[model samples]
Target chain A: MTNCAKPSANCAKRLVNSMSVSNDAKPGVNSYSLRDIDAVLSAFEEGRLTPAQAFSLFREMGPQFEAPPGQGQDAESSNASRLREALNELDSLIGLHSVKRLVREILAFVQIQKKRARQQLATEHLVLHMIFKGNPGTGKTTVARIMGKIFRETGVLERGHLIEVERADLVGEYIGHTAQKTREQIRKALGGILFIDEAYSLARGGEKDFGKEAIDTLVKSMEDYRDRFILILAGYSEEMNYFIQTNPGIRSRFPIHIDFPDYLPDELIQIAELMLKKREYKLDPWARNHLYTILTKHASNLDHNAGNARFVRNIIERAIRRQAVRLVDKENPTREELMLIRREDIGEGL
Target chain B: MRRCIVLGKPNAGKTLFVLHFAEFLHAKEVTIKFQEPVAAPRKGTGVDPEARTGSAACSLDPVSGSDPGAHGRNPGAGFGPSTSEHFKTYKIQDAVRDLTGPRPHTTRCLQSVVLELPAGKGKKTVELIDTSGLTDGIHQDAEIRRAMSQTLSSVRAAHIILHIIDASKAGKKGAVEAMGDVDYQVAAFAQMRGGYCILANKIDLPGARDGVKKIRDEFPGHIVIPISALYKEGFKEVKAFVLREL
Candidate 1:
């Protein structure tokens, strides 16, 4: 083989693995197929082939090269499997029990409707317009993104990406500009999800405000697109409830309402650990206790929005920075010195 | 539909690439939407006779609101009534020849053509937008300036950005000469976003191989796809990138 094909030990390892998989498969299978793909990829990386050639080669390999079980069956089932993988990912998240259950319910409801449609039975329309009431950084946006992917996987949406916007993005200056701006956003979110953060603000600035115009435009788009796109209006629980109650039209339109409660202290700690683990760092016992104590104090402070996952994320990130600062001068730091976040680095309260 | 907006300096073969890429994707007929910038709403605002002589004026029926046929006499210089929206449906061949030429700033507005690519199981429709060329300094022409701002807005909204650079220019000299300050600024801004790729165009030209090499060196860590946009030689990669992104 050319040196280009074996650029790194990683490539050689994948080749060995592919050779094993090829051997395990029935005879007559192309044993060199995976290696061929790696070779072409490396060649393209080295500027030996144009993108057109690489793409055609990739397309040719799509059918002939068999991926190991659970990797991906084929292109046809990839979308569905991708959706399943996303759900698995959601389930793997630290907390949000109620959120997971609600997602499962939506999936089951959609699947049943699909079956009913196939059987010629009368099926109810799936109006997925949702109101997500939560404090800041409570995984509302995160869940909405995953929901977009899930909806796409379940055939509810065509393009399951998320278009996140705020009141400023929707409400424009001038008389007719707000509607134009709002409609532009709606048009962009057509085949996916329109996530309106701080959505209650759309009802603020009085009845004559351009926010009202944006709300009107949004309502019209909801009716026009109907099932074409999913609109998720997210905000604080109390404000969102008030906003919905005042606007009778909004209350009647959004059928699904999900409330994200603040994460408990233990959950926050779990989240911190996960975040630290992801970055190849670990919280020592002393730092772990410090984090738990800080989280408990903050959660008990009744500031509801005091510290959630975002707060944990900030503290962990800060600790990582502090750790780096503490060790940057060392000639050769040990593995533990590099990976550990100590108690002193926790700093004072937020 | 996801939007893949094409942006670059003037005469970077953006129009040719859009037309040819659409054709390569098997578009029988394309519905082109020309979103004329709201700037310069007045009639006959910046028409200059000096720039009107080189190109031939071929009159077709007005495709949209109020007759814009008044400028048919001086087609090159007087793009009259460009503030109003227009739609043109054309076959690939006619579009390729008519939309692309040697002149700079041929596309003065946001012109988008919708094309579909067959994804794994289904087809994905994306609007491939062609915009006015960007310059390093502020352009003196009001129409070009308006279109430049329009292109910038489209850049912000686009999920996938294909930054087309003239490889022939870069090949002969260094990237600093071939690319402009605006090109670097645009690339720098787009670097933070995902689905941004640099297309080194005019690879069929004599010096383009070196230009592609220079582009790769200049914009390290960017996905650079080299192609002769005129011949649609590297469309498969563009297609794959768009499909993966969308």
Candidate 2:
């Protein structure tokens, strides 16, 4: 019967109801988080908690108390910021403009589906299984990793970590071994994403091979654990197209097909520079010019389907080694001298 | 299962409205489940002395919503425990006559009945509960006080709160059914919950029109359905609201 439980009547007589305007239009059942409020009021009535004690228990029942703790320091705002933070990482990647747009669309679609579910409206089935078609290093794995983070932030997935495997991991050497290996990979990928790199190779041996068993296993697991994990098939675009065409069942299953287009030479240069900056190194003017020449000629000189990022990583890493060898004999290299990579660092021609 | 609770001050037609609402949902008989107030154990947070410091005004944050584990708790920590539960099946008309009365605080314990609502393709079951009245100040009778506390606890856990206010007695400045601090507290506490709505009852009585308008004007932005609990006038809107929320 203390004043804390019963406030002055006149104080909030004209208070405007902000419930309708708050919580990002979700203004639904999430607003009044349960049981804790009941527990407190009853405790107060039972005299276990003082009026003052009950009042503050009610106060500590803040907005994000419902959000699972330990993941976010400040749950309410940080969950939202994490989504943006994940998206910003997506945007910072060089090229893949269409991938970025499509990612945003997928995010919007996922968010709308959740809202529709909240409202009891008919939400479209969340079939997020996707086919990522691109040559190696067209940011396929990078985008997949980012997608997992974005999905986690949106509450779509639990762990959001990536388990990457290729054909050898799924299609084993002998008979029943393929299914066991595939199942093990699927088990490891249950909460997050199962990224199958060079996915088309599983379909390479045709109907008579053990690869067919692996495909059947993957498709069965996708159905067996729908909504539990997201399956991403990534490889050379043409081979992926042929793979989907032959296995007619796979096409309908993965509704989203994102084609990772090859980065233009200029775009490749930008990617290389970004990579250099991340490695705490800078390209001298001569070295930048040398990189531009090598990448521009890379189309005719190198294997067409080799991962673009992989090739750049190869060149950058090799250059770092060559630069180390060149500066080894120096009396004492300045910070700038150590940081810079000269044209001589580049392996000539190849 | 969404729990839609009917609550208000004593003699505000809460019991009648609940029975009428049950009938409105096409129930011929209602098996009412009676539950007494039981203390739920507080977990996840340690007891702190600072709980006495903050303002008591309603902050609609869901408390301990993260405890999916608490879904399965020690027996009585959920609802009814220790006390023997009484399940009485009464025809809709018998319930109206037997449960409701003109005297204040007639309905003491928590009484709830499950009614099915037509939602899209399949039907959904919503529990409609009627409870004892909440008063402005502490009452001398410990039984009534405990019942009021039970009603408050039910209101906290309910998915939808249908606060039944008597329109006929609303206009007078100082009447038994006059809006008081308890009403304001309930309104503010339920403000953040989307399933909260007001039902202005006794619309069949004279002077009830003014009461409905006054109720609407006083609590702006709230959906107030004017209904004669005896006549079941605004039962359609109530059903639609329930359907949408459930």
Candidate 3:
């Protein structure tokens, strides 16, 4: 009944609907007994009552007779679960324990600061200029992209796109050219994450280098646009620490720092399994053994590509291609044969 | 200014409704702006119905021509982008005798009258447009086909739509006022916009009540107001609706 009360004119329709339901049970459902319906019809006939009033009379007859439009996803559900979708993607990564913990802490801090502002309390500014200390193929770029989605869902960025740039993309060849190039990239990164890979290389040149001009432009724009964008400087741990020590202006502005650690041999195998599961491909026992050997051999090497998930991803993708080639001459491959990556398909080199 | 258009089948008394509505708003003199018809622009959407508002307002005797199609059918060449318009002002009685008739195509061009309604502290201008009647299939006359095309374009752009349905003849299947695919198309198109109402016209005649009920059943979730356009009945509710939207 209360549901019908919400829409006043719709009452007439609701009452008419319920009156039919009562015709089976109540013996008084005859013409003379329904004086209320007669009144509504007469008012409707004379054009004396507006559409809303007539609908309300319909509603006044009855409302709570049936289940209202059952078990569907209503439009007004909270956005928290939608935001959790991005976080779930973040959590589902095979490794990066420390990175996930730091992300949760940063989100908690930002949420609390916003709630403080809502209550008229003194709130901290959300300066999430981050420094990512990691090596190549260590999931730094991937994490940056996920962070962009999370920040956009949290209302920190209008467009959660990631724009990747290196020192060459930021620094220019001539005088006054570096700032122009850097500002253009910054313009593209506004309302998104600006990921500068191998950022320590920006300080590799002498004091009079164009890289200095690029860094200065970045620091100035960081303050000018303040919360309009997020910037993440990524490099090796030692080099990034040294670079931060040399540039005093950038140290205080970058309040959050996260480290993308290399995966262990076991975690690397899990990542390969997750990737294969996502592609709907599977490894036979022998091929799985071959993958374990390849991963364990590279586990202690500590090279630029050692203990990296990207290396495993490339191997899986190449093996899939090799499997496709192996099956092309056959009359028709079954679904299992088509999806299987065999022992002969695995190769260390491209 | 937001446009509120009136559309229906021919001889449905759409012209009478517009004039009586103007008089209902206390309009003493009605200045009509008519855009001369061009070759029927390739049918409908995204095409601009070039509604040429009058630049020169020439004075005419209160009663100028008794012929309904005199002002609209300017025999000028009908191509290109340049569109000419004709304007005339008339008292309510003069407009009724001249514009409204039992014939189907009395209004052959895009005719609009700008009326003001009191909003908050000032008056808000609304251009009330009367369009040529639409038919279901291929029209015999090319000029009417052009006018119908113009009506289609105007219906797409107008902010408010007042679809006039002839209640008296709605029960008769073969009559001009019978519900057709064109009426359904208008209702379907207008459902997306903000202000759209169905005025079930000619309610003073018999069989109109059943017709109104049928209209309500056919197009559920629409506001249907039964009105006798010639008698000026139920104009107050329409005015209130227009003012609320304004």
Candidate 4:
């Protein structure tokens, strides 16, 4: 028999009061069921949910399920939730607020649609297709995740999820094979978002290319499941534009294009700091200045470099690794001892 | 069988055109085969479809023969009993393996039905060869340039050439300039010396008419047809045009 906790008015009142307190105490915390969390994780695995959306949803649910004494239910659930949230938020460990804002807007739209559905109003304004055109590491995946959250919050999606995939995943080795593979990916991303990174790679061939089969399948599915799924095609701006125009079906379905601009040097530094903080470490003032100078030099040298947060994070990691190796004792260095990443740590001419 | 090749520039709906054409043939209950083959297995343990079926034979293979019309019906006549027997158990896996193979040689051996209406006659079977788009500028890679050259060499023998233009982009300043440049190159090609039909694709877009008009104005004597390749619009008109010209 189902666990029948009577719909007691007192219990409902207590629930409401607890919810209010949770909301007031940690506005960032999300309140979601275990099923919802599973859906979000599945979406991420399937490339339908972005990391940001998963993070935002988990954040909202963090404080809601407090441990009840002896039952041990709340503690286990809370611990699992915190672990998932930490991993999801790790993507944002390198801050790019512009990308975050874009993700929030997507989530907001999902929430609005959910409200309409509850009121029995038709959802006419929901965006089912989006295009992310930018250089690599511009946080396109991050934005896709946040959009998933917005969808969950708005009630457009039962469980907001984001799945990230690539051309190789969708395009098969053969003509008929590509269609089936592409279909499977779509099935995996059902009722959620599917992000196709380097989407233009699907168009990088001639008449007999298997990528064409994937494109044909994607177009048909997009039309058939317009309400249930959203597709985000991301790649280098110029190539992506050409890729869309290559197929008439793609051009019609994906009308909205979101451009992700490369980060400036200052933005890169801020991202570097965020990465350091995530590890519970702080940079010495001089070390920070030295790191910033190295980033500025490298950013100017590389043509395809987007001044991406990932690049800064990677450089910081390298510096930390160098510092660790040079330390008096390589193993078991305390946080304070490792806190000051030096100029020498970054290495010469890097 | 007679081979008809489809050739054009990048982003000119070449792949979409071929896919839709294949679908159209499939709807008519015609057997179609693609030319390109998939790469070999990583560990080399299992047999791919291309190895099973004799269909992966090169277009110029002397043993397989060039006449697909006769060989398509009687597979044994060209490639011998052993090769023909293997093809009997042909699956879609083989078709995909063939389609995905990286052939440095730019030969494509596509087979599809050609619905032709000559006066009061019904549709007939005709093989279609869909080749890679021609890149006009100097290729940085010598291998790619050679492959493209080989593909272009085969186009001279094609019964028809489908020159697709982006109708929506035709009226823009850049597109207008590009159209002029493309027209000169295409018109100058000895392979397309006889003449070619211009397919003004993407007519579903707002500025398609203006683009088509610009092309028509620029090349008054050339045969130009407007179409929305995505929506399958003007496909009948295109089919009729191909039938008459071929």
Which portions of model 1 miss their true places by more than 4 Å? Answer: A1-73, B1-246
Q: Report chain A TM-scores, every model.
A: 0.79, 0.80, 0.77, 0.68
The digit string of per-residue lDDT tens for model 4 on A28-68 reads 33233222333333222222222223333333333233221
lDDT of the structure predicted as candidate 1: 0.73
Quote fnat for model 4.
Answer: 0.00
Lowest lDDT 10-mer window, candidate 2 chain A?
A11-20
Interface RMSD of each: 21.4, 10.9, 20.2, 30.8
Ranking by lDDT: 1, 2, 3, 4
Indicate the TM-score of model 1.
Answer: 0.50
| For model 2 chain B, the run of ten residues with the poorest summed lDDT | B56-65
Cα-based lDDT for every prediction: 0.73, 0.73, 0.72, 0.56
**Candidate 3 global TM-score:** 0.49
Q: Which lDDT tens digits does candidate 1 get at residues A216-335?
A: 999998988786788999999999999998999998899999989888888888899999889999999998998888888887787865547898899988998888999999989999
TM-score of chain B of each: 0.81, 0.82, 0.83, 0.60
Q: How large a fraction of the reference contact set does each model reproduce?
A: 0.00, 0.08, 0.00, 0.00
Q: Cα RMSD (Å) between model 2 and the true structure?
A: 12.5
lDDT per residue as tens, model 4, B18-130: 54655544443323443322122212122233422334444433333444565454432211011121121122333323332323223333323343332111133344555
Docking class of 2: incorrect
Scored by TM-score, the top model is 2
